[model samples]
Target: MTELPFATTRKLGLVIDLDTCVGCHACVVSCKGWNTENYGVPLSDQDPFGATPSGTFLNRVHSYEVQPDHGAAQLIHFPKSCLHCEDAPCVTVCPTGASYKRAEDGIVLVNEEACIGCSLCAWACPYGARELDQAAGVMKKCTLCVDRIYNENLPEEDRVPACVRTCPSGARHFGDLGDAESDVSVLVAKRGGFDLMPEQGTKPVNKYLPPRLKDVAPQIDILAPFLEPVSKGPKGFLGWLDRALSALPGEDR
Candidate 1:
């Protein structure tokens, strides 16, 4: 079985804003495209064109219609991936030492070469973040796009995770959560970001910003005065036409 490090030098994770996500699945598509092409193995599909198509994906979005106590129902788009917990149960449960967390940066990853296709990690994960690749017969989860973020060939701006880069609504943010002054940390502090399922004690690195409640009836209502009319009557070409029409017989002045 694998053992987690006592501490990591940095905690790199995502801060997702629930209020801005539009459930467009751009993140999902980008993740699939990047991971399949560059990562360990291509994510496979079974019966893609058939009635029941199933495939491996590293990121997925779930939408829930939630009704606040005082407001109308709202649809929340939730994107789910590996949380890379500080005390990752998936790591401790791995029998072959394939699943491990990085000591330099707290990113959980699976060593595909060492993996024996055991489903233990998937079972241990509470977030349902792991998926067994049907073609490869190995468990796969999100790596936080480690290859892209640290690659020197890619442009600086493109160093973020594919999901973060492709998010149309700017809902996904990636940074060092460990740093108190980091942008992600500041956003989390300002938005009251929270862990998913805190009771699990996994100490997930990723934080989610809660959706701000929609405004109900206004407590005070004040109407603005109507704007004065711009002109009392037509004053240009329309004025000349009006004068000509008024001079004609039987024309109302």
Candidate 2:
């Protein structure tokens, strides 16, 4: 049997910092814009301007409110995308061999020409990464901006993936995960990075470093002023209306 090509273990992946991510959807929008034009079929929207507009997207950012202390909440924004696993379940489950990890860079990609429109690969992915392009009748997911990265026409600094390039908060970093000395590797080491849904044993290459929290107590007096009642001024019509509304009940008013 031929040995699995360890020669091509470059493991190109992303390291997303949870601390710096400011819940901006720039990465999501940038991804949609780039993939829509370059990917096999555009990420089509059904009635884009109408009610209940929906479209296919390879990456999505989720905002979660985490309350670590009493009356204190931190908004955590997670940019969810393909992890590009070393032991990718999606690749193994593909009947057509369309979903394969690139030998050159270890990036998993769907060969649109070879794909049989089977959704098995999508089902195998634990991260919910694969999206079916209804228009093309094939599966699509993040290519890590393969074409853009390799394009010589683009500037050297601008050659990274769209999501990483467009992140205003500097939350996303793309580099060779296989290189132990890489910046991403160092960041992962220093920050105690973790992979999402590791219990599935997919061995995801990408990592998410949790937000670091300081133990300092928040100043309570800052909130006290907002809680105090405002003294009523000379009663104009609007002021009378406000007083009447405020009198009608809830403590918040």
Candidate 3:
């Protein structure tokens, strides 16, 4: 039997549920911790206590307020990171072959040794996934926890990315998206998943399941037991005088 290419056999990806995410940043903290300790270089912060503090991070959670003209406001917390695209622009734009997609698992990675500190790859990426590691003088991004995911010494269940494992709300999922029978594929199919910035045509593997809406009644019962009544405190001397004056004939209060 002809062997399938390694990339096709193992296309690792993430499936994010927008509906379940509560905007908590546990995943972000987990990613920072894992990547800083285990990956090529640390994600560092500059002037931590200063007025305009800045830091380098592989993952960032963006909170977007989505409001409809007729409905209540909806908060969408989108955790942005490397999508590890099948056709990654960052790889192509790299002057050196420092940025390349892995043939074994389709994970895009950077060879820091070969990188020349040029920011071309960052520009190529429309998703703002790449960040410059000033300390190492190279571009950095999410490795999908490459070191941990493939460690033979680690337990099988703990082999997943730190972000995926640490998510409190179960909003993050990691699996082989290429496989039709994978849980991610099933979730995407069932939840009507969508890709962000499709116009860029990066063909990002990560899928985002849109938030589901709750049903609301057209009219509310103001006098319902569950509803609190508005407090009407006694009026002051001005109010008493106004009422007394209003009781007078032809008085307009």
Q: What's each prediction's TM-score?
A: 0.85, 0.83, 0.84
Tens-digit per-residue lDDT, 1-253, candidate 3: 1111234457898889888888889988999898988878788888879998888888889999988888788888888889988778888888778898877788888888889989998998999999998777889899999998989999998899988999989999999888889999999999998988999988888899999876787676665877665655447887798788878899463
**Model 2, span 4-88: residue lDDT tens:** 2454658899999999999788998999999898867788776789988777889988999898756568788999999988888
Better of 2 and 3 by lDDT: 2
lDDT per prediction? Answer: 0.93, 0.86, 0.85
Question: What's model 3's TM-score?
Answer: 0.84
Kindly indicate the candidate among 1 and 3 with the higher lDDT: 1
Report the error of model 1 at residue 230, Å.
26
lDDT tens readout by residue for model 1, 38-121: 879888998999999999999999999998687689999999998889989999999999999999999999989899987989
Better of 2 and 3 by TM-score: 3
Candidate 1, residue 126: Cα displacement in angstroms equals: 0.3
Ranking by TM-score: 1, 3, 2
Best first by lDDT, ranked = 1, 2, 3
lDDT of 2: 0.86
